[model samples]
Target: MPTTSSARLAALTVAAVCSAASTVVLSAPAHAQSVRVHDIQGTTRISPYAGRQVADVTGIVTGVRSYGSSKGFWMQDPSPDADPATSEGVFVFTSSAPKAAVGDAVTVSGTVTEYVPGGTSSGNQSLTEITRPKVTVVSSGNPVPAAVTVDAASVPGRYAPDGDSAANGSVNGLPLRPDRYALDFYESLEGMNVRVADVRVVGATDPYTELWVTVKPDENRNRRGGTVYGSYAAQNTGRLQIQSLGRAADFPEANVGDTLAGATAGPLDYNQYGGYTLVARELGALESGGLHRETTRAQLRGELAVATYNVENLDPSDDTFAAHAEAIVRHLSSPDIVSLEEIQDNSGATDDGTVAADETVGRLIDAIVAAGGPRYDWRGVDPADKTDGGEPGGNIRQVFLFNPGRVSFTDRPGGDATTATGVTEVRGKAALTVSPGRVDPADPAWANSRKPLAGEFVFRGRTVVVVANHFNSKGGDQGLTSQYQPPARGSETQRHLQAKAVNTFVRQILDVQKNADVVVLGDINDFEFSTTTRILEGDGELWSAVKSLPRSERYSYVYQGNSQALDQILVSPSIRRGDGVEYDSVHLNAEFHDQISDHDPQVLRFRP
Candidate 1:
């Protein structure tokens, strides 16, 4: 459930250290046979000698993590095995601060444990660690193993081998093919020291002192110097998360297009959040790429601009109101209608049963007006307390902000959190039974999730139906780097149902009056090519506008190191059948360290 990169890193480290807490320690025999690191880490994902005690394991310490709860030292065997599938390095987990230093020749005797980074339920690959260590300094100043260079040529082009069908798509039992797949290649060097020279920073440095770098610079490179994740097949093998083992304050703060100049070498560790990670022991200096925030051109006179921005849990207490206001006024070019997601209640997460967001919305509106933008009025139904899921008591919901000068909101009565809005023919025109109403809020698809908010607007004597949605996030889904091949996306079931319900509602509106201008937009939390999207675009009911751009320019969010489309805008056939529509996924956020929001706002302009 850790959302941020730093949180996941902390969680993984905590889980790894605590994995041996409940383990029953088994002492080795008096004359146990000496074992090499590769003997413990076999050709498979799981360690061969797991749950057994190994004595007299000889290796030279390569890196030492003395800080934090996960205090341990990474050691690499100078003498390696002939098999390329097995790793030469291993982590010696000490309950407290380790007494080992880098480059020290040491002998360790401990119970070999297959520590799953997140947990067994996470489907994350396990780390072969030696727990309950009995360390002895054999000699001083012995040379460490040479760091393996991880460049474009070293990492295989293929991502991972498909799992065995009989075992429910799990590759844990499969033999490691280091030369064939990138996942296998990384697993082959699981605990080994690896280096990447002058790697480009694809993911910006987050607050948790972690960033992402790619050895394959040219693979799916975007205009903004990011690796575009177009589909499930292309996992961008070279993208690896980098976390410095040094001080957090000393960690280099980098932007998306920057580069880590010189060699950044470290023990390759598999994390719960971002699969393969290089925990930097030899840190690199940050070289700026001069990346800057972008601005979109203002909407034309006849075009009504609509945009969607997930403000990252905006509330009255947040100091980001001014920055978000500037992003709306400057970067977004002041869209006529904007759908704001994650707008917390007036009390934020205080859990005082305050469901109203008037103060929060009012502060943002005031900031916009102060920033030379129009005084935008907002419309949204307050959800029943704790019914909507977000930050525990935040009560986050989708709210619509419209500029009255360009468009007018058609307010109808009898709309609330539990009320379901229906489309009806009024004077031979498509109309909502209750404007600013919930779309099938009672449906099971919306349980513990935000319901779709549908509203009617008048623009230049034409009626436009806009539905703002914040679908269920992909929280419980296994990541792309999961041990299971292709990974399981269990969270998609709810999203699939959500998409079906939205598509059904849109169909109802179009059935009432053909050629109705309906714009559906928000943080969909799924890829553009996903089944959820395909369901939303059922038959010919709706089409995603982000796909109108080239494949490289279709991303509104960045996760790990891949630029992906999570926030999107889809329009009905009436709106898509013309040449007047224009869409822009404004690159204001998601690529910089000082972003006001985590998601980039998407704008769609068209004549109704």
Candidate 2:
């Protein structure tokens, strides 16, 4: 549902164009009056008179947008509608520059339509609009409808309604519950002016001139000022996307927990990226949360530092290598070993037969060394052609980069890209039969997905088994702002299976040596409190290093206003109980617009 960063960027452009269209003015001849906006926007998700021509729809122009192909202006009825569920305002899609001005009492003749942004194939709900309009400015300088208040207490707890069983999980067929459902409340205020107060920024201000805020306080709120994406709790009930479409300046940069001091006024809108957004023209004063990019963690003398970072599909062709290298050196304190995910093949995303990532991995190592970090050695199993699901021929896989001077690779024979590595007893200690090997490469859980890359390293006379992983993503899951009730999370099923596979492998190492030092690190693609994480830590066999930090400082990623942990560093119980096992989520990325990756690197430091 357009959860990717690119999708957010695209939405930003679309919102900007639409906002420009809504605020700009043009000239048109007058036409006769027809239907009320409330009659067109009934108490349902879909317009009742969709596809029918309605004449003389009268209202005061509240907003005008004249920039994009889907240009429109918002109009609100001065009088009232008996049904509170029905909205008194509506958007008139002029399909060009709008010919109306704010506060102009206008009459329009048009066809009522439910135009789905991004078309019907996008799985997005349709927006009710009046298209092919004939506009008549009946009178100018009329008072517009007063904005309605939509704060935490006034907002409904529920987000969706259960539709008919035959409607395929959609609430489109259901009657509106404006006072009970957040989606219904938004639909009720569609095109009408509304104000949100006492709002806390849940999502950081992104490059797209948009931000996400929550009217209600969350349980896992970070002290630094962002809501932790804890287990699926409130379902983002109070979270709202704020798009300053018609503003003269870009929205100010904000971190999680920052507050908007005054009320933000705008018309509620539905778009492709997020389901419902506030197309704000006026934003209140922003109160800072004192959130800033964190500095690199200190590497202690006796501590062996380990970290996990998702490079967000790095390839030899991408120019982000140098910036990423600097972040690894300066922001992550040059960990002794780093688990890198999403290393693409040498040819990048090209669908060629080339599957090796030597060039891709080598360039990063060179960049890291050039950036004043340790000269590192790397090991990884290139996936079998394109069987691993990723950017097709890009063949994204996890790899380990270790500082050769500090740690030695336990290089045993029989390691390849496709063979599964087995645990064996060696000299009365836990050891992998092949030092750099795949963990159950052919396992069904890893079908069409990147397999776990297992490597054994020797640090200060002690052996540490590090398993690097990049599991399937949440690509197929429905967004929290979906029209479907209890949004589908189908992607978690694969992740759940993948977690079990990794957990079983960890169990194998523990069975050989109960006190074995094992660290599972990479882009796990799930939260610490998620089911996938719980399965990976089955029976407390391993401990998540993130929990080592206070509850308010455990996020490694941010999306749609929620700061969450997706990339994780989990250590076996022995490591957790060991001395000097400190953990930190280095926030050089994720919270900033000029980020190197969508994920923040996490480090676990301990003396084993």
Candidate 3:
């Protein structure tokens, strides 16, 4: 392997002059062809292949020690297409070239000498390279400034990135290959350029931006300690072409001087650490540079609240709400009342009572009874027939359940009692007038997808409106492939319309709120960081429960290591009356623990 032109020039001069003395070319021209890189193939063994000069010797650098004081013994690259061996190579490193990035690509011209696994007792001809190997630094193609390199400690995948830290015979562990292929390579970045979320963001070298990309391992492989590679290190630099977004222009918020991409022609292959992982077989920098903004601040409280949870999808036999009914019952003990989401509808043979999705409500009712809380019942759901029925085991998601002991019900403006007809509107959102005639569940289904159930609940002689909401998921119009027929982010216009409707509904809720005491609960499907939450929380309305904490401590639950704030509680100013309401989160199953529901039942307290 030859290093950069300047590096090899010095080495070549030494080789030429030293050739005449005892140093032979071993050029059996035909045999030499075997070392022609492209001609070399098959497993690379130091023994049988001894004295056999092979080209393209690519293998893991199990042992990286500066041999004798002047040189070091390391393995050669087994070629991009070849397999890395457990321990190959007895090459000599001559401090030649300014230190080679270990997990780098090396082309060595060598004569192998067999050495025992750990070296023989008598020091037999363990494989050894007579000539010092030259090298070429590969690039990850990440545009980085010369001032900074990647932070190796946070590297997500395996690889001893430090040029000084030497390994004897094995490398570090690797990542569980992403559902999609992934990897981390090294690159000698030139300037200040870096790619973010597929988009290449440029830099002016003014306000340095350091970016640390992280990909955590699953339970099977516990490689902990934030695998977020640093600003720009050999371990952090690499040109990965895994369907990455290219160009500063291609990506929104992208800056100046960003490299489009210098990625490999195709997808990354599974690097052999233990299993599959995406990493750079070889990588480097693209110039420009990096950025890293560690924000510890939490999102401030907002007026509108939204949340999501798996709840294991409550069913007839499953009393999710009822089983956890204690939490809600205690919630009502506060100044404001709470809204229910994911209330299952009876989904069996309706007339005869064959347990179906609609029948799930029984679980809640039963649980409530066992707890002996005020007779709280649900309203505002779909008519048994209209709730996407037709084919089989019913899976209806209704929103009902109220506590009569806490607040009195009031029809919104004007409304006849609801029916079991299965029309889009089940009982229409039931209203519970809080103290002084304030609605606990404030706004009704104003627009789109079975809008939230709203009403009033009385607390401390003061009436407060409560609005329960469950919005669409940002997993991005998935069901669209089938049910929606046309994906919204795609061609279908209505899906987009539906999305707008959801947004509009949120707007309406904020608009009609009578006081700052409006508390919004229930699952809102959207996360705080997303556009949905932002749009819904509109203009200093609802106060957020989670955002009030610091960012690192903000997440309520984690999925695949990505901590997200899905289940949320937002209180209006009225609860605080200017001071903001008191709050706490019930994360029994969310500290990386699995529980009754995917979403935690959040709670808020106020003095009303």
Candidate 4:
């Protein structure tokens, strides 16, 4: 006969056991390792630390919050770091409305995932890596019980009041407890069931899908022997998450974070060799989608190519058109679609006292063609530059130039104001139309990006979409960080917004286009993982051309100590590996110390 306190604890213990048994399995990128998706030796059942998965973080629900249709509950250190590790508060969302709040400890297990750019406020950036939210609730704490401390290292492998010991451990990625980054202060929680806070995903792509959680100082790092747990719901993706569970704790319950005397979840299932195996389902999704693989061409086969370059403030000559034309020529080369960002209204004040919106494109075309490629008859520029370049009440920054024999104009170009939600207007980021040759709406994504410019192109009987863009730069009137899923503080707001815009535009436009094959080339002004770039990866179906480049050739520009993919050539799923398309980034500009425009040129070749 147990006392009232004992009975309550028993109930909690049962819930915890059940919660741990359930884990959700979803499609995502993987770690650079080949974690065997099986059980470990002598562990008797399944092992939770073998899969690229998440944990069922259960703790007192200290508080709750609201954000439009999405809401969240707060929890004190969900997973305590092994030592010296900092623990951020954990926030769990149910639906659009939060169910718990400060002091109301709860347990949730769901797939851990990255934030999509579409839902961001400051737009999107490439600064922050990834973040995950709570999707499922295993149990709710009324006045979320205070967490109990467990020193598994000093105490022993299986320390418990009743000789029942459990813990968790990690080989790679998990902070070694002495780090100053997010996971510092925690060695590893091998077996014990400890709640973690501020849980988020770090890596993407197929093999680097890793989860990072903020730990509390008192978190358990022991090696527990039982079924492990974690998850992030599919429908919830980055927002609503429900912790994974197996069989709703069949036994009695236990107190929050308490060292159980004889608690154990049965039939553990391990995968990937990490600390957790995903349960089959979580949150509102019975299933979800994963990476889609397709075959591409092996070689370019020497086809003529086209591309764009964003020459930042390309005013070459002091003699207006002559100097402007000459100075710009220093950075010029051969390409199809050459984009200009920051060209003077006048080629240097033009001949007439009035800088007739500087016909930079028209002149550059003459020089580049005179410089010789195939033919330079066609031309396309944004803001139309008829009035000499001032953007009315704004400034002119983006314009495009295409060789007539190489490509033709679509004339469906337009601009909009820049914001977290859509592309920029006022010359910040603009889009123009052109025909790659197929001359048909191969896909609906001819236009995509924060300030994307779309056009139609025909390649060897196959119609496709080509989008050119000049996104907001790292230097602009944007915040340090947008109010989005990324918790990174380093990336600028405008950068993030542009990233989100690219991501949202892709997912919203290309993802839905049935037969559309989309490709985007632009100066995103961000590094590979910058929050802005992340949106492109997380949401948009865009794949980086850099991935195809060797490490030495991966970088397009250099700034500060970091070399980034500021300029990129991305393609959608459908046209990923078409027969005749060839992609590459040409070094026409940039290197922290090198010459050329602040950016280089990216070229693509396909039969038209």
Q: Please give the CA lDDT of all the candidate structures.
A: 0.90, 0.81, 0.35, 0.36
- lDDT (tens digit, per residue) of candidate 4 on 237-331: 11101122322332122111122222121111111112121111111111112212111222233343555566655543423343223333333
Instruction: Give per-residue CA lDDT, model 2, range 1-608, as digits (tens).
Output: 34333345344333222342322111232343356888878878777777677898889987776654546788888897789888988888776678798889998887676766654544566677877789999999998778888877877877667656687787876888888887888888888888887688887776666788887775356766676776575465777888764642546667666788888877787776677777776787888777677866677778899999999899999999999899888888888999999999999999998889999999999999899998899988878888888987888999999999889899988888778899999999999998799999888989988999999999999999999999898986777766666677888999999999999999999999999999998888998888899999999888888987876687889888778889888999899899988888888788765677889999889999
Candidate 1 yields a Cα-based lDDT of: 0.90
lDDT of 1 at 260: 95
lDDT of 1 by residue, 1-608 (tens): 54344354555566343655423222333334579999988999877677777899999999888765567889999999799999999888896789998889999998788777667778877788888889999887877799999999999999999988987788887999999999999999998999999999999888777899999999999978899999999999999999877777788878898999899998988767688889998877899998888899998888999999999999999999999999999999999999999999999989999999999999999999999999999999999999989999999999999999989999999999899999999999999999899999999999999999999999999999999999999998988888789899999999999999999999999998888999999999999999999999999999999999999999988899999999999999999996689999998889988778889999999989
Query: Each model's number of backbone clashes?
Result: 0, 14, 117, 143
True-structure RMSD, every candidate: 2.3, 5.4, 20.3, 21.6
Rank the candidate models, highest lDDT first. Answer: 1, 2, 4, 3
What is the TM-score of each predicted model, taking all chains together?
0.97, 0.88, 0.44, 0.39
Candidate 2 deviant stretches above 4 angstroms: 1-34, 118-123, 157-169, 197-200, 217-220, 247-263, 284-289
Residue 32 alpha-carbon offset, candidate 2, angstroms:
14
Q: For candidate 3, write residues 1-608 as lDDT tens digits.
A: 33122222223223211333312232232243234221221222222344454544444332233211223434333333332222222344354432544454445555432222111221111222424344444532322211112222223343322211232221122211211111212211100122223223211111111111222222111111112211112121222221111221222222122332333111111111111111222222333323221111121323222222335345554535654654444422322234555554454323443423434655655665667655555445443333332223432343535445544444443221232111112134322322112121122332223344455444435545555555544433321101111212321232234334434433444445435255666555555564555545556565566566544444444332233566677666555465544455554443211145555556554455
How many clashing residue pairs, candidate 2? 14
Highest lDDT scorer: 1
- The positional error of residue 30 in candidate 1, measured at the CA in angstroms, is 12
